[model samples]
Target: MADTLLTAELDETHTAPTFAELGVREEIVRALGEIGIERTFAIQELTLPLALAGEDLIGQARTGMGKTFGFGVPLLHRIATADTGTTPLDGTPRALIIVPTRELCIQVTQDLDNASKYLKNHQGQLRVLSIYGGRPYESQIAALRSGVDVVVGTPGRLMDLADQGHLILGKVGVLVLDEADEMLDLGFLPDIERILGMVPTQRQTMLFSATMPGPIITLARTFLSRPTHIRAEEPHDSAIHDRTEQFVYRAHALDKSELVARILQADTRGATMIFTRTKRTAQKVADDLAERGFSVGAVHGDLGQIAREKALTKFRKGGIDVLVATDVAARGIDIDDVTHVINYQCPEDEKTYVHRIGRTGRAGRAGVAITLIDWDELNRWAGIDKALGLGIAEPVETYSRSPHLYAELGIPEGVTGTVRKAKVERDEDAVVVERPARAPRKRNRRRTRAGEALDQTEINSTDGGAVATSSDSAAPVDNAGTDDADENGDKPARRRRRRRKPAGEGDAAADNSAAVNGAADDNAEVRVTADNGGHDAETADQPARRRRRRRKPAGENGAENGNGVAAEAAATTTAATASV
Candidate 1:
């Protein structure tokens, strides 16, 4: 019936049913058996029957409770032509499974492939194509064109391909939404509804989630057509992991890495995972551990899809013993062999805490989970602790060197912090690229004077007579007509009164040159006459031209009278030259 909640669950005392016993097809059952998956988990045992009958049901189970196979097996079984006598395979998709994250899409695809290895149709083995973002569209488009019987992809990529008319959902008979609550948490509800609208309304729908909140329940009601709600949890089963041993320590933020390092070196430690609240912190912790000589890989939003997949692959294949991941990147990561889970930083809430620690203690394995709570994060962690009913409201104040930490995680006494720190130089995390330093710059300078270049000899030598060689016998400077004399033995400043033109071969230029020489001769003669005429101190200091100009007007002032003849002779010559 559509409105029924099947509360029947397989208790621990009761033996679980095998895939063959639950009427799974022989090919699928044999394929699963090859991988040592003979008996079904509680969720699979409950879901296989209803899912095989092509009924819409909501499967609920905690994380890592074999939920992928619970729906994957039935989806493959019903899609095979021999099992249900459905239409023969074509290139079109027959069953569509939508997951929330790229990692989960890959995980679900791998599981379906493992189970459907032997199950085939008239064409060949079932084609399960994985499509997700951060991948080229060409490859996925080509896969769809070649032929895929079942498609497992995230909501975004699936819608993109559907919109572009590459992935054909019209023929999809069975529809599944794996990790339904995670989809809601990631704000994929609208996209999920759109995907639901794209698929045929008469298709078999199954929704599986770890925790059912109001939104997920409402979603189930709106689209699931009163589907059967099958919860695979035991009666009175507490939400906490029964097999996982949790230890919460009030640790300083700065020293948490040291504490984690010690815990990682514990004797009982196997493959470990560390979770952080931010992408940056995940990469930091990963690098920190790597420098300590541990093979650590990091997965986060900042990493490219190739790098993320590489880290996950390496973690699963034993190539790396530790993986540091953020909440978003670590979603849908189902590794059963993770022996220890370390919360490198605080999680957001109880829901995140459950999903984070659930990464370990999976597939019925006992796991150890340790949480380091910072002083600032105590309030946040208290809320999570209260929500989960963990009695450790105030975490024990502990440090990396605390004896209790060594005792609990089984760290050997006196174990060094560095398990292999001597090799840090060659480790991948110790590299520091040195940037090249810039060269010094050379400056060009100029020393300038306004008009003419002053030579050293010109600055030192002047037209005045030189002093005697002996200091006591030095003659006094007898400068008569200096414009501005320097008592400090500096030369007087002098400037020419008239500008002279360039000399040419014309008789007029010759005449002008003769006139300039005659005036210089007149000034020199006047200086001599004035010096001899009981030299008037003020008049002698005056320029020789002023004296010559005054005495030239005095028709017969002694020197003027003498130089007047030479001036008259030059005047006659100049007049004759002009005529020529």
Candidate 2:
């Protein structure tokens, strides 16, 4: 029952003493007063009467505008005031509230719990428990086993607990869809439908969301039976609050931390929240702020639930003046006096921009919202501006330490880093490799060993000289140029040389060397010497008698010579015949 600085007074134009005056039981009024909530927001004023009378209700209001109580109060009131004689035979819940976020579950549950204080013995007999991921199941299971009159949870968790036999909804008399638009945006409509099917057909359903977008409207058409529609538009759609002034600044990424420090030096109203796109950015921003000696906390998905909750609690309790968070953490954060919301980086879309600014200027409380847009984010802002109908396509150029920005936000002028000192040694020692070090220079070191010599081969094998006529077949009619042309063109590129076959047992060199030393006869020596790369005089000098012997008895005497030479000769002759 702590006093809520965040809650706004009831909208007097609609009605005074609304919920209680609208034929709601005195018990419900006393329950709300126990929680120090004596007034109703516009959403609640419009929807309470119909919903309390068991009529279906649809409430439309932007986020952070007290839609939780719009449906939560009536639903809980119905559960508490229901007849005890009609106990649900199946042990199913009498009321169900489905929200998009786990944080919203806690939020809606708090409101429901506050409303349940007047029922019976005040043991919180409403059996209210929040079911969501990132927590163990045993507590929720035990709560359901013991019996809960109402369940507030996300779609997935609700369906999961229901299917596991931990939660029964057949007797559910009231179903509330909080943030129905968000559920559709997250593609959870099918899951919501399945949960709806589990509830009794004869039920009073309430759908409350910031928008009655097409999907949500269609959902109401199918699920709700003649529900009355209510919409509460924000007082100022695109303008800064009366207490809030807008400061658009363009700053270099490197100078942003310094600028934030300067802003902190100015008079800060209450707790401040900075929004960053990424978890790492959130942590970095928080660290930067904390190093400046500011009490800061960071909440994002990367942190464990306990740490996130602790940070949120510290922020709520005023232990921390600044909170850095990712977009996900900022959702369903129902803090009212979050004096300011700073967008460290421009959000990706208009919807995100709306939600981020919605954190402040909540529940009729005036608050400030500032956005720091880099040069590259200009195009992104263009799209967002068009979507939100903001004609200012360009943001004023700003530096982290702009005097105008300081004046606008009521920050002190000419104040440098007062809270956190910049780490001089750390910045000097920081190793920031802009790009990967140029891959090690690979030197092509050429070396020739003493024994391993390089081949002194000519690039072009042909001499460009006239073809020469030799004793055999006109010296093979040199066709080197023709070979080069076939492979490439007329370009004088180096042609790959054909390697000489190694000397084998049947090589001509072996025969020539053997014959020269008188190991073979004159005919074999003359025939071997008549091959390539040797003196023509040696072939001619062979006796005419050797020539006649070389031609005589080509088959018979060659075979008789033995030594496998005749076998080699026969194989060569057969190859030549096959070619022919």
Candidate 3:
């Protein structure tokens, strides 16, 4: 049965129905006409009536099949047409939309806001607010305190506001869980359950997803009341599948960037999207492409909310030619002008592959999807091939410089990895858009030896004294002159050793008396002070002596100093013998 459903053909000869024909209100019909949207897609045609009739429903469709309006149109209509007697006008929300990501929250909020241009609830004109993380809480709180008819937000932020008493869900008449499968994948089921418990049980609930997995079915059974399951089946030769030309090739991992750079230079390529499996890979690919002279942007989880929004704005306005993103961040990105999509790495499953490629060939436009498979990811690609029934079970082996790649992809002859020089110059000289700068960080001051020296200079200058300019002046030494005697009643010698003169001549007189006391074992106190006589002169001369020693050449002065110390000890022995 599933196989039959998957292979079913859609009749192209049948005319598409308009929004007004589906019982949509005149105000919404006018809004749609203003945006030049007159015809309804298959999903909208099937689910709009059921949803507007206040029936619990599940609408299943592909990712880019106009599901937003299928549910959005009815969601707005129900709030506008609700009875005023029961519905409260006391600044409380009437409808709630819960999604899994901040990007999807913003997308859905914008779509709903555009659709509700001329819409009104029982209170007054309809107002919508998008509440998500990375935005300040005060603004959301103020918007709720004022009036809001609809609220679209992620589960975590919604619950946070609800717990803080800033959000009230009791009066919510319509609840929607968009992208239910993604929410389940992100582990938001517990928060979803708690949110469901907060809202009134008698309200109408709607669930929509690209694929109805077992968990989604169970979730629907638990929350939705006897819901009607509707699947918008596309023809096996659907426009999206037919218009896109897909090529799968086994590529070397190290050479993938070079291949992507060449593909971006294809004659038919316009704005392109490169999908990777991880955030790190996405950023790396974007950087590599930028170096190749293509204006590129990156959308990933690591970027701040402001940065992500800025990149998306640039891509939408044609400021950047390429966007690299992860699967999670690329959800709900509906850009119709994207002419090419490249899979930098193999997707994990069939659903992911479909969604990644769906970013292009949208709105009936032709596109190209290229998948590069590594040696390790062959098994993963094979599963996708089998599930999609694509005839290529084994992809063709291709290299970065292969001749067939250029011919098949319509690349100009003689083009290499780098973009043309003229194009590079033009892009380099283009005007750059600047974003607001972040605040400057405060740095801590650390103390070092050099800093201590400077501090000493400042202190001496303040005290009206000559400032010591080198670190050796601060070297610590024993203050033996302040003590009169040692433990044995003999004073410690404080004579300064001279490197230029012989040590025997400089200190023989002081050593003679000291030797006499030592040999006689007498209790007399002998004070061997420096030739400079006092502490003040000794302290002043210490730095000069150290400077002289450091200035001496290492060749002869080093040996001379060693020999002088031995000669001084011998002279002291000779003096002791003379005293005996």
Candidate 4:
């Protein structure tokens, strides 16, 4: 719990004094005056006196309330004062400012740099360096080796450099944790504790946040020593600025883009910011606005660090009139001229809604916030509305062409969704031609027989026939003769073939033939007479085979000689000789 609470009522009569009147250093006051930031915001005015006295405090305020400079100005002032015994003017980092995101780190670094521009030490000028991830580590290491007066960095990168012994936190006289609630939301509590342990406990510790959760308060109770809690507004009911006019409407999901396009054309509009729940939705809304001829840019988690920085830079410089972004990626984006904020998609809770709409209506300027809630998002929106005490529980059903919408937003009559002329490359009245279907390919097969290729004329077939033949074919049947004339003018003759029988009875016939024909044998290159009447001498040189038959087993012939087998063999041999 905070030991002391200071409620600074911020209302229409904001008669705050300038930084010079608050006893700020001449250099810082002059530097701020050059940037046209002379007057102190509520948070700054309340926090400056306590913070400059080297007292620990917690700053609780709405987003875009100039909280960065609240702790930043005091931090620079203490580090720049050479007479301070604890914080001597040296290159060693006398002050450390920790933020949650890289964008916030850069923003805080710029703010402190501007305030400390003319303040100096023996090393020449008061140096402020930004150390965040997504940039090369070598440069940051080199910068640390060279020494810096004040350091602004995120938790992860700060811990990395500290662990590597490249950063010196022992000499730090002041430690500030900016956006402490966002760090808790991002699960950086452990790293934050580690950083708190590293810095000197005797130094000044200041914690700032837009909202304080249970864990954040617990962290403060554990680390901060009797800190003072300062709230710019009264309580939960005053979360949003009084100058910001909020409108909620129940709209169809499909008509959201169309409705937003019309809202961009509303009168007295300047740069606008459209908030979405997802990176994809942010990109979609940005693209939709771009196609409608609106100068738009986008920043989300999906984009690289450089791209996000570039979009924010363009938005600040007036290069883009509209910016679409998701909740997490849009933190620390401060632009003074933002006039309108559209909720392309309903935020998750009251904090997100406040943060989104807080981008506009900054620096005590009047602004407008319009929310289009789909039917499914009504319950979620109701919870936010109830939490923030925004009594518009049942938003009116509206569309792109609703008369009330036009009147409420101050849209001119006869205005359409698109502002740019669409280009039509193809003629609308051109004839529609149909292309023909593709044809199938043909197949050609090459036929081969006996290691020789056969031409189409050499192969002739009859459908469902027992035999097929051609006049010039080398293929011939064993039992059939061809009537076609040959090149030598000879007629083909029929040749007969017989199969050989088993070995038992065929051995006798084979022996008898071998004995009778002498050297003439099976498949021998010997001349053979044709069984037909025709005699073709050229065919006689080819080999021919003579078939044989098998011999049967003799009955009881096994008892040869001593057992009647010899007598049966003798009788058979005599019968064969007589038959031959």
Candidate 5:
């Protein structure tokens, strides 16, 4: 019977049967029974037999189809048989399944676990585990220590754990890459290569993706050996596209969030999922909606696994009226009754656009997919429109107050824009004005001694010669005022005055005693010589030498006493003897 169904599926001879008539092994058939999935979809019917025969196969199908089970059942069956023959080293599994997201990891692991339930060998010999990011690694490490028969995880987390020696993949015989295109889209090809290198070189490899782009084709060629390509027709968007009316509105970047808030207030918005281009924008939109009295939740890569699960649960259970999310959540959401899908920001391309709106209008329900575009996103939207043949060269320019928006979404006219209301009117309550910030104060300090002296010198030198006084003027005045007559004013002849000593000439009396005595004896001769040039030259030379010696001590004794002639004479005599 299995051969008949397989041949009929390959040749189109007869219509395929229910999963019950597919002649799958009793264990798998019973596992599907528990999930209430009694029949096989066309893609599953075409690929399961080939996969179970250990033949390499390629499956082309849309998202949300049962492709996971098509390849999953055979992998689980192979794992159970391989486990019975040889105990894996340190409890490593014989099978490995790599997915693209944490949510898919959880979903696929649950499916594989269900499929492995009925297999024998009994008494706690088999184990299965799923690992992904946004969760602590303690539990995953503990699971690996105990051993898992099948490992399901995203490429990044799987490679991270494997590289850290927390996971072992040396004995894996069955390797499944699910949603291979998405993995490439997310730039995880290098990580995938590292993971594949760890598995046994010769193994049964199966690759499943929705649309096989050129890169995926190259990947399949490199990984599989003469694989049979099973091309399943893209699953018709039976319930989604048929029920959702798509619209694109061009607005300003700053006003996109306002448009979304208006859409949330629309009467038809049962529970809306607002898609954004980045995780930060998702959080911002969610927060804005919450501030407007709407119950909103958010989910993105930055959220912890528990928080992500909680937000998803709230969105599905009507606890949140609006859910702000990014493309990562777009593909993983499988809820049935989301009434509106709003693109708060334009998507990267049409593939993403389709996936974003695909969240709603599911299960034969009519819904709406509304796109709010900013001026900057127009070029991006054009590229997407051409790619999907949307033919919408320009989107309609819209504002928060557009009448058509109010008519279509059933929002009132006056309630479209954002505004913060005052708590009370000025007449009803007193208003307190806020003080402005104060400027920094400037500090004043006293000047140092050196700075004050520099200032005074600058003041004195500003007029040049007017402030230039000779430093020796005071000495000349004191010498000119000295007493030359006694109190009686008599004409008595003056005693001979001693001349001052020159520098290095210790005593005045010793240096000039002969000249003084000769002058007194030949007073007439001295007078006649002074009248001519003989004694005048001598007198001029003596004062010039005295000035040179006095210059050094003049500044040093600016405040010294002048009435100590007797003591000075004694000191001079003592200095003359000491020098000799």
Candidate 6:
């Protein structure tokens, strides 16, 4: 039966056949009708019958073709038709759909959920859950514990849950692997094999891929049991190639951003996608375009799952006009209205190039795919061109300011890289805002000490400066000027100054002579001489001026001064000298 079905010629009629004619369950047909999908694609028409009959099959189709529903509709129908009444609703999943990416997983889950809406009325209520990384495991665990009829997820997270006993695959009635080629590219064949080993041997399995590589064939032989191969050959006049205009240009890396900015301003431009080989390049290009006044968003691996989803949602809703992304975003995104795809850098291979350009020229809409190849990447681009049979071996030389670029892309004359600000009122609730540049502030100059011309110079002894010495007479002047004086109006309070020296000295005679001479030279006597005018009077008495000496230590060889005044003056001079 499988060989006969594989050999059967697929119908390639102009009018598509209805889902009911293909033996899809009534409930699924009604659900698909509700979503406005009345007719089935070639892939769907070929695979639906084999899948609905519980036959193992392989589906081959391109990126934009209706591959999801080809397997999705059958998988949902099988679960709904099963008699799960006797089985406990212990959260064991009955069907599994493993995809390559989180985005694709969510996409497939949504599609399956929509198709299974009417399952409650036909067969008991069927629960569908999407489990992937970047989401909390508790919710998925809780959903599994309650009950789930179908589960769509990535390989790593599915294996993790299965290993932890949260996901029970023993009862899985049907298993589907979507994008098997992508999984192989991502090195998930081992994981896929492990997961296949966990499921019951007597179960229906379906595999779908855009391209059938050798590894995928080996994988199918190992797991699938006499699977029927179904290939949906695109029509000769496929709308994808007919609607999309392709251009290859050898551009300088330094001017690629400017060229892209101008191309974005083309009259025919709509929602555009820019692809780069690296996440950093994608983010840089997005930021550069945003700074140039284009409303742009970036999607890449560096962003969190929520942020990436938010950007994609905004792009779909027309909030952002341009989306810059890496090749990771090339596989799962399915936006229909994208009018332009700009390859900011050359893609690594032909398959990647096809996927990147496929973002545009979708759904029979006319689109443009522009590839900017750098000087060093010419060989890589040539390889892709030869592999895909693109006849253009030598791309045209172009620059950001080239006249041919403006003419070919339909850019207005004199248009530069910058976008002019719109005169219309801005949306107050807009999520992205263009802030005005801040003004520079003035700074004050510091004043120098020379400009102020201060009178006093701070003398520091540690820096080896001379210490100024003043006579003892200066003390009398300070006392006379003191604000706090004794009540008797005589003298203010004074502190005596004492000078001490170390015990060792040389030449005692010379020291004694120097001390006496220093004392007599500095001292001044106060005399008392008075006379009466007329009548005789006793001579006025004057207090005698006496000098007191300080006693010296027993081991000292220095001279002692007889006059206390001379000694204080000599000690002051000596102390000043020692300090200097």
Q: Write the per-residue lDDT of candidate 6 for residues 493-513, one digit (tens) a residue.
A: 232222322323433333333
The lDDT per prediction is 0.78, 0.68, 0.76, 0.78, 0.68, 0.75
lDDT for model 2, please: 0.68
lDDT of 5 by residue, 445-501 (tens): 222465553332232222111121233332111121122333333322122333444
1-580: candidate 3 lDDT, tens digit per residue: 1121212134688687899998899999999898878898777888887788887888787777788898889988887877322365456888899988888888888888888999865567789899999989999999999889889999999999999999999899889999998899889999999999999988888898987889888888899888888777753433235678999989999999989988999999999999999999999999888888889999998999999989888998999989999986557788888999999999998888888898888766888999999999999999998888877778888988999899999988887888743533457768999999988985533224554543433333222222224533432334422222244422222234332333355354444444433333222123232333222333463421111112233444333344344434534544554443
- How many clashing residue pairs appear in each of the predictions shown? 0, 5, 0, 11, 0, 0
TM-score pick, better of 2 and 6: 6
Number of backbone clashes in candidate 5: 0
Model 5 pairs whose backbones collide: none
Look at candidate 1 and tell me the lDDT of residue 250. Answer: 94
TM-scores, each model vs. reference? 0.72, 0.67, 0.73, 0.71, 0.63, 0.71
Predictions: Cα RMSD each: 17.1, 16.2, 13.1, 15.2, 19.7, 14.9
Q: Compose the digit string of candidate 4's lDDT tens values, residues 200-289.
A: 878888999999999989998998888999998776447888889999999999999889999999998999999998889888888888
User: Lowest summed lDDT over 10 consecutive residues: which window, candidate 6?
Assistant: 526-535
RMSD over all Cα atoms, model 2: 16.2
Q: Once model 1 is optimally superposed onto the true structure by TM-score, how far is the C-alpha of residue 292 displaced, in angstroms?
A: 1.3
lDDT of 2 by residue, 1-580 (tens): 1111122233446554556777666877888777667777766767776677887777776667678877877777676767222353233567888888776677678777777766652243556778887788898898788767778899998888889987887778888898787788788999999999998888888887765578787888898887777665443454223345455577788888888777766686577889999999999999887777888999888898778878988988888878999887656788888888889999988777777877888877787777888888888988987887666687887776666777777777666775544465657667886976788886533234564533211222222212222223333223332123222222332333333334463444443443333323322423322222222322233211222234335555555344444545545543432332
Model 1 has an lDDT value of 0.78
The alpha-carbon deviation from the true structure for residue 329 of candidate 5, after best TM-score superposition, in angstroms, is 1.9
- The residue ranges of model 3 lying beyond 4 angstroms of the native Cα positions read 1-9, 83-88, 121-125, 234-240, 420-580
